[model samples]
Target: MAIPGAVGASIVDYTTGFPVATTGAAPNNDHEAAAAGTADVVQAATSRSLYVSAVPHDLLEDLIITTAGGYHLLRPVQTDFDSRLVLYVWLDRAQGNLAVARLRMQKLADELIAT
Candidate 1:
């Protein structure tokens, strides 16, 4: 929750649709459901051709879903060994800067994979 306006955060395994770790209040106070939902969204995003980049061989990096009250950010964790993890964050729109939060998440995601 160090990111500004972040209310909740989780590291989810998209391959298994499971939460590896979580913090703060989850949507509906259920972290498992949240993780599964996140996995579904990420899966849809990565699979749909509409979301693909024009550049050849391009891959999905992140996804942002905005609601009236908050923003849900999803960053795929790319590792040399595997690319099945995602970092998810829930940020209050009123208190969050989308660009900044995005950058922070990118950095955190990089650090996560570095180790």
Candidate 2:
């Protein structure tokens, strides 16, 4: 929750829809449901060919879902072993800087995979 406007954050195992860690308030006060939703969204995006990059070998990096209340940012944690994790953060649209939050999430995701 160090990031401005961050209402909730979670490190989810997309493959299993499991939340490894979570902090702050969940969307409906349920972290498990939020993690499952995160996994579903990521799965939908990755499964659809429309989201595929035109550039050969390019992969999906992140996703941003905008709601009236906040912005849902999802960053896939890429690792040398298995890249099945996603960092999800809910940011209040009025107070959050999307660009900065995205950058910070990218760094955090990298650090997560490093450890």
Clashes of 1: 0
Task: Please give, for residues 1-115, the per-residue lDDT of candidate 2 as tens digits.
Answer: 5688899999999988999999998899999999999999999988774676567787888999999889999999887886588999999999999999999898888888677
The 10-residue segment of model 1 with minimum total lDDT is 46-55
Over the stretch 52-102, how does candidate 1's per-residue lDDT look in tens digits? 656788888889999999999999988888559999999998999999999
- Which segments of model 1 are wrong by more than 4 Å? none
Model 2 worst lDDT window (10 residues): 47-56
Model 1 residue 102 CA deviation in Å: 0.1
Error of 1 at 6 (Å): 0.2
In model 2, the runs with Cα more than 4 Å from the true position are: none
